[model samples]
Target chain A: MASLIAWRLVAAPHPASLEDYPRPPAPAALRLTTLGDPRAGALFWMLWLQTFDDQAGVTASFKKMDFAHLTAWLERILALDPGSEYPLLMATRVYGAVLDPGRQRLMIDFVGRAFRDAPERRWQWQALAAVQARHGLGDRQLALTLVEELEQRVPARQLPFWVRGLHVIILREGNEIEAAKRLMELMARDGGLTERQRQAVEMWRERLEELR
Target chain B: MHHSRQHRGQAPSRLSAVAILAVLTLRMALRERLARAMALMIALCWAATWFLASLLVSDETGPQAAMLGFLLRLGSVFLTIVTVTFSLTRDLQNRGLEMMLALPYPRGVIWLGKGVGFSLIASLLAILDVLALLPLAPPGQALLWGVAINAELWLMATLAMLLSLALRQAPLALTMTVALYLLGRSMHSLLLIARQSAEIAAEHWSAVVAQQLLTVISWLLPDLERFTVTDWLLHHGGSLTALAPILTETALYLALLIAVGHLELRRRAF
Candidate 1:
């Protein structure tokens, strides 16, 4: 199964590029390193995959990685092949971190393509929702719709603390602080507060009180 | 190992650990000039807090701000360095840790007992400092909240000790702890940089690597900034509603640090 996945990743055609994509120039050292390496192709793919893994596990797992290092890895992977599954996943996760609307839109389009190819994957849906929300796309109606669908399909018992927390954020961002507070209180009562979740709830509560 | 179920006399093992910790603290209080140094530093910090508070006047910022500002400026670095250095270098230097390990009690107990003892002493100093700044602080819950924030500082001190044990080098452990402190404080900024860089230079290998490393560092370090409620308490005259969560997370982080320290310490041949 792993081999098949690897093969599919390697054999997959390059993903279509967004027009006027603002690709930052590659670092001189990285470009030089890749140019001389015989196995640069495979190295690039692996680096791309590692970047996605880092993002996936960022909150609770990848605590030792610094921002500069993560960016460098993503850039290196993308430099080798922009269309790889690894870079696509990394772009989706990175969207939440970026503030620029244009950059976020590019990531969203990439995610949209990934979803079209793999419609059944829930993560792609979640990524698209996040990117769309960040970009203020479609009156945010589409993002809300995706979240609503996700909430229904993701059983309360099975949902990760972060995913659940994201729903609370959605509520608060939508000016539903009271509802968000209530939801956070419920989560705390149910012992669902991961360290980060608890901190987020506290921050949200403080904001709500300040507004009040 | 003798297992004494009933104490016909004093429990020597327990008494011994307590005695050791007391002696250690006393010696530290004396040798490192901790007594006189801490006293002077605390007084200076209190004066600074007073000055800052006077400038704010009747503003909500008073007790918590004074306490937290003083601690961050003075207590955190001082207490952390002292605790971590004593826990790591002093023990190995004097071979005191080896003797303690030879005792009947579990090594974990000894490590924790020492941490608790150091934390208690640090907390006492912190309380005194906060009390000194009370005159400049706003009335109401500020003092109470200030004490709570001090407790968080002591908790971090205990955590530093565990890291000292794990790393087994005073300087390196102190460096790492401080680095973690900085990382936790600048988490939002770090995340921003990672995301922005990734988007702008998606094709740049170096940028990608940089972002990945930042993510890892963010996850590994305990976010000390979250416990910094003194500002809110002082400036806004408000208490954190997330006290329960904060306490829970601190406990988990402390436990994990101690557990990892124990594993590392146990593997040493000496």
Candidate 2:
């Protein structure tokens, strides 16, 4: 999972140019267009381009290339598409994976900007909540707001059970254990929790008691 | 003339039987809203793939790969829920068992026929969904082979239906079905947990029993996770070679469940 997260982060369209990197022969004739979906096809190519550039930067950090040249490459890519969702989401996701306090703040800013621009997008709301939870933003106030908004917008019957699970997680993180417990009970009443989920909840309850 | 009329009113001819069964299953499936729900689910999955694809940057190596991974993991779970709730539950509610028994056909034959019919429907849906997802997948033959992986999920649904018939309670049946799904997905993790727990608390019999139970359930239930080829499809561009073995195992499991269901139905007062 950690490696996967790193791959996504490094693959984001950095503002860096690929020319600084030593051009290795393309490994295969495979191109993204053959994969299908023009949108995804474009994204795949962009990811490859960014990955090559990022690797060049790493090499520069190791004194394989001029640091200024690598920096210029990064700046160029960033300049080309500063507002793209791909980089912002990838950066935020990678930031979450690393759990770095400073990087997390940067991720939150990116997600916030994305959300402000596209408030209707569920991904933006979810990403914002995730970052907010990690950063303890507004003491999880942002997380709560996003959850509430999602609940109101998403139909109760059609909502995925994971969303409700997220709400429970938020409540638990906010020191609302009793409320979380009550919510679980309500879900049980509504036949939402499967037998295993209920069992897992029981285990959680026991662990909570030990903590208390 | 009376004797000829009696023969005419008897069981349907083979051609008519096939046509009637096809129409009945399709019409009933549509009327119960299952068809609409499945269509909506497919649409949502396509939308999700598009959204995820759009998030990939030009320089990323694994964004498309990761999105595909996420979709398959999430899609498998959703498919299990939908299959069990919609297909299996509808059969139970509509007295499908009674209808089957009422027919002059052998009980086992009826069970096998219904199972095949439901499996076909599920497979068709799975194939359509995979085609819809093709555009978002990484370039490979493995991506195309991922279509067959959905058969495992359908097998689980068939098993769930048989179990529900045996249990005769929707809530309990649904709970068990979902539990089976979770167990199938997390079997390896649960086994590791059990092994670790056993070493830490060897004296606790309850813990030992829990571990044993989990291990048993993992093996007893269909391991739907084994059919997951999305990782290989998106990353390595390799076909799922385990398709034949998995299909055989699923068929065998379905046979056993249906046999058990047949026995239960045979003994049922109604």
Candidate 3:
């Protein structure tokens, strides 16, 4: 229990960053049912891992973890509670196994549905997908598509104002300026913008014209 | 130099009387024959949990942490029941309850004071458990758990008192209280599970009857599950979204239990 608390304190600050060790294999031997509370189901997995770690130590057990186990565990957790954000977020962080594109794309697709369901979470996850598409997989087209989707999702109020005009922010970080401009226009029309936001939008439009 | 001046010359109001009762109840818990034994048992249980945790070969603490949490909650529930039942039964068996009723305070106030006192003892005990596990729980969650356990105990204490008043025997009252508690906690989950097979529910008249009975019982009973956010301690991000509603519901239920218990007490011949 003490160790778990320590891990949570450590994990909260660094989103998606886990300790450098392999994750344990899925507990396929345990005949579990999602018919009860999903939280309880997730707990079963946690306990299963802890049992493995007891003798080997946590680092050793986590080191034994493979990508397949992580993906499978997450998929099951999501199935049990699709709206549960923990599994999706935890899995999203680790899907890219050091620039290998295949697993990352598969995870992005898996989490995309959950991200869409959770509107507030859309920006961060879409940004992640965009990064995985661009640098990790070298699929610029898929990266561009994710950025466009992110642009549609972001409320103008949330994005920092002048930053996008001078430099592209989260959604358009890959120099997808045109998509950012279109999203800005939509926010401006939506019309709850602060004075700073409106000015930022006008400046961004001017900057867009100059760049074009 | 009047003794009344210590309390500002006011006749001890119902609140003061209740306060005295509560303090006395706490003292009574300590003085009870089982108090030391129970404390020792709890100590043994915690040591066992720690030992069991050590036995698990995994380095990841999540699994053992979960087990500890489950055991903590289950132990608390049992402890609350035992403490409430024992305290109330002793009071009834001895002449102490009659003495309290003989005092100038309203009968309802006496009942309320006893209930509050029982809950206070349970809360203190639960807090001790929390402190034992405090290093394991996160900053906000330990306090959240304290709130949850208090609410659950308050409800259970109210139930125990009600049963004690309605049935004079300790064993019978305790048996009924446990039955009611289990029914309260499981009723909703059972209904949800049964409803999944609507065709089965429809085909079997007995199933529909049981479902309806469960629905009624749940509506009347405290849902103990609402107070269990044990995972929030483990960074599961559980919300206290229903906190206000749960508090409101508990107050209403306690009020209802007191009214019925008071009426039952009144009907008894001295």
Candidate 4:
């Protein structure tokens, strides 16, 4: 027993990424039937995903994951319980922080697609995805496109005016002076902005006039 | 006239026999160190959940409580199966079971007595689970989860006892009980799948027949889909009124399993 313990302490194992592991295809109906509760099934797989550390350690870093498989799993889990915010949270906050631009875009796109399905419950993730597009990926065009969709698609009353006015700010940053001025005028005319938002809009319109 | 009077006299004797046998079963489980084993399991489960909770990046209370509830439920089911099956198998091996059956008391006295004993053991396991889960979940939700889990474990215990009496071997009874428990837990999903398939392909006879067969199996098996729900402990949304169907199903299944076990015992020649 002493020799075995000494040997175990001396030996080292090879480090492996989470990509080395095989991802199971978890269909929603089968999981719901087998586990009998969607929340329980979703929680089990969510916990299982944390077990794949490259080293013999406590938690796996999202940087080491295969984004394709991770996106597929997040999709399947969201199908099981659409109301669950954990999957979306992981997409935007955890996996979105990876250094790889391609993987970051994949996470952003997954969040975007999920938002389209339940915009009322998930607009914040979409907003974060737009921010990632602009700042992280250095793609202002994609950010402008996403922010425009949010403005047009989501119900106005469900979100605050600041969220709704994000497209104008993006357009202004992109130097679309005429379009930004038009959107702010339309927003002010619509009579939905709060007093503070209206004041900010007026100040921004004056700034845009000088830039033009 | 004499047989009828003897039947009347047997009632009180049978009651006393049941009480005596129940006490004996509890003693046997105590000798098997059930409480110590269950306590160890509860501690291990609590530690594991606490470690998992620490790994979460977001607010961890709800998911942690859900995971703890799930692990405790699984542990209780496994312990109940092992204790009930192995204890009965030991009694059968030592001829104690046959000796009891040879007496004038009806076989049900022996069956109910042992069933009630195992139910007590199940209650003990549930109580340990509740205490372990108390700090993680709300007290009301935790208590409800404990009662629901106790009902689930009691159903499993009665089923395990029936399987042991019928199969007469430790390994066989244990295997059959686990298989049946898995089947019962997943049967609801199978029925739903079959129904969907039938609707999609109404002209296909295979789908229709499969639906019919699963319907029969669902009827014969205990519907365990709602047993020990984690949502109750997580405060997602469940009330005390929701336990009515689970309790009713458990009582019905327990009575049926005990009756069938008694009939099986009567048919044995020993």
Candidate 5:
């Protein structure tokens, strides 16, 4: 059984894109290392799984694992300790769609579920989910709904400016250039826009001008 | 007559006698195979904690916060239980306990000394756990829980001594000790559950009876929950004051267990 599991990990077909892989499988009990405390348990199991094949002759079976398995492992860890920040942060920083789309969406999906399971930094995570929704999965409606939920959940100041900018970008991509320009102009009214964010908003307004 | 040191020249002071037993118990633990395995296990657990901490994106000390506390509470408890129980049983089986009882010292002093000696092994492990977690946990909290785990182990050791005396076999004594520790830790919640169910059923008599039984048991058994603040210490830095109740209850339990063992020894034919 161990050999078969190892074989599956090594020979699993590469997902052509982020959309290719299905949702991760449920975790088996043997994989759990929880001893009552969730956060500590989650971190411990994640590290142990990462280093499972670190013996002298082992081929490092952990690296060859596909996103499906990785997500399953991560899902189990998150289930054990939903409040931990490791799942969202590690998924974003380590797994990106640019490198492997399948792995990227796996993390994005993980983060989206984590957004509901653990609401520690819900707005920030949902905003990241919005970016992934439009760019990674090509679901503009999902992106819009995520941004909407993000706006409602947090204070106005806490919402990232880039999240608002993504709203304009999503609007432009949806063929609502006029609405996008109006939103961009509304953002221009904000006194707190950093110098770089203000430059991005000006670029958006300029592009809308060219469209006119 | 042979057991009486008073006839020869002078009797050993109570302090020296206990000191001798303490050294003997420490030597027994040093010679025990389980102590070595326990050392390796503690090191491995810490290594795993260090690795887990490294995987965090921000490399914060938060992930490592519970490292030593968990080791002290869960891991060291089991190791100490096995070591203390097995040593006691070995002494009994080999007739070594008989020879010790034949000595001039009372069984109370001997058992207390042995408990103290067995507790040192746990103290050493707790220290190692603290040093491993030194970089991860706040120093004050680490030291506080370190002392807490030691006191907890001493309490457990005395309990093991009493269990071995009562059962006269290591395997059964160890099993019973483990069960008692688990039940003690969860006793508050279990009693609450029982009483809540009784209330739901409208069985006033059952609730009253359960409360009376729990009160009696509480008087005899230390509430193991007092030692279970690993989560509090992990999430919020703990202060020395946190140990007050735990230490008090642990000392009380230790004293009771020794007193009981001393009485049990007096009644025995040996």
Candidate 6:
């Protein structure tokens, strides 16, 4: 019993959260290292990235995170399981929520590239990212660029009118009233919108006129 | 004419002996708490899967399905290896094998009985695993995953029995079985790495030799990567055509292990 007590005192373990972010291996190398089960491997790392701070019962501050290194991991994970939206969701919601403007911009840019890969499927994250840029980072230019890219890559007909008119709203926010009115006019002329969408567009046009 | 009739009568009795021994093997395992252990493990695995599912950000069930499939398959393989090997090695350590050999049944019947008994246990585990998966995965995909898990566990069980009998020590035999399984699972990835490295450094003869050695080893070992794929549960239901090679490799390997085990058993003077 004395020996056991002595051993316990000496072996008192201090568990610490992982604070340092390491760059992830290339996708091909990671696939090889995981014994070729890319799906499981990708998921394991994604979970690790998601819960790394609280792993040892300690919460590492988000400011401690190296967004560049973290972005690399997200990219590699998405490369491994391209169909998965978990990584992008993390980038837009969790990492993008960091108070550091530079890190927030980093996540927004990562979401932009990821969105380009599968525009139809990943447009939601891109949309969230644009909102983050405009509101969170207060970078209107970055927000406008993202909205333009989303408009170009995803077809206006495929999107609901409200989503299609995101750029017009951004333009109005930037005080480009003439451009916003012109774009809204063009959107109202389209015949493909649902009754609900057309009504939403009319509301937006009236609001823009009131603002002007 | 009298000799021929005697032989005919003995054949049926010998076959019956194998069947009886198989039943006895299963009963012994049950008495050793195999069922209870398997149930506990399954419950724990499912609970963990449920907890992890809530943490996933994706709206689709693919990640959850993949996780359940992976956990169940891994747990079954680990449990089968430990149970089969430890049971056989215990019999060997306690001189139970000698007592059994003193019985009237031939040595070959004893080996077949134990092998089939382990295979039956594997089937039960597979069925339970698939049932656990049904909530997360489509039924058709779950069934395919179940079949592959069964085949993979069958291979593990047979290999465990053979190694335990040959080595007659639980620790050594278990280690060897696990090592072989890990090698088989990673052989495809190892081969790819070797190929890439060799191509990158063509002037290095060591890389070429390493690649060739891995190729030969891969051919000798079962390609375990083809079995129990999580992708099958995540995507479209797996086709029967894809299962063909896995089943074939399992059957062929089981035959080879049985033949080798039989010869080893017969040659030993116990």
- Chain A only TM-scores, each candidate in turn: 0.41, 0.47, 0.57, 0.84, 0.62, 0.89
Clashing residue pairs in candidate 5 (N, C-alpha, C atoms within 3 angstroms): A18-A101
Q: Residues A1-212, candidate 5, lDDT per residue (tens digit)?
A: 99999999899575433222234433323222243344455666666655543444444332354667667767777765555666666666555344555656677777777776544465577777778778776778878877766666666666678778778888888888998988887788865889998998898899988876
Better of 2 and 3 by lDDT: 3
Model 1: how far residue A146 lies from native, Å: 43
lDDT of 4 by residue, B32-87 (tens): 78879998889888898888777776675777888888788878899999999999
User: What is the lDDT of every predicted structure here?
Assistant: 0.57, 0.56, 0.64, 0.81, 0.70, 0.85
Winner by TM-score:
6
TM-score of 6: 0.84
Give the C-alpha lDDT of model 1.
Answer: 0.57
Model 6 chain A worst lDDT run, 10 consecutive residues: A27-36
Model 4, C-alpha of B28: deviation from truth (Å): 3.8
lDDT of 4 by residue, A125-156 (tens): 89888888888888899998888777677876
RMSD of each: 21.2, 25.9, 10.7, 4.7, 7.9, 4.0
lDDT of 3 by residue, B46-164 (tens): 77667766754444444444445556666766777777777777778897899888887778778778877887877876776667566666646666666776777778877888888
**Candidate 5 residue lDDT tens string, B1-270:** 554545676777778888888888888778766667777877777776666566545666656766545654677788888888888888888988899887777777777677678777777867776676677777777787778778878888788888998898999999999988876765655565566656776888878788678767766667776674554444654677888898888777777888888888788886
The runs of at least 3 residues in candidate 4 whose Cα sits more than 4 Å from the true structure, single-residue gaps closed, are: A6-23, A26-38, A51-65, A151-154, A160-162, A175-212, B1-24, B99-104, B188-215
Q: Is the docking of candidate 1 incorrect, acceptable, medium or high quality?
A: incorrect
Question: Comparing to the true complex, what docking class would candidate 4 get?
Answer: acceptable
List clashing residue pairs in candidate 4: none
TM-score of 3: 0.57
Q: Which segments of candidate 5 are over 4 A away from where they belong?
A: A1-35, A43-79, A87-120, A159-161, A175-212, B1-20, B31-38, B46-75, B102-106, B135-141, B181-256
lDDT of 5 at A73: 69
Query: In model 6, where do residues sit more than 4 Å from their true spots?
Result: A1-18, A25-29, A32-36, A55-58, A155-162, A175-192, A205-212, B1-17, B50-62, B93-109, B199-203, B234-241, B266-269
Which structure is stronger by DockQ: 5 or 6?
A: 6
Candidate 2's residue-wise lDDT over B208-256, tens digit each?
Answer: 8988888877778666555654434444445556567667776788778
Q: Write the per-residue lDDT of candidate 6 for residues B20-131, one digit (tens) a residue.
A: 7778888898998999999998998888878887787775777888877877877999999999999899988898878878666678887898888889889999999999
Error of 1 at B133 (Å): 3.3
lDDT of 1 at B136: 50
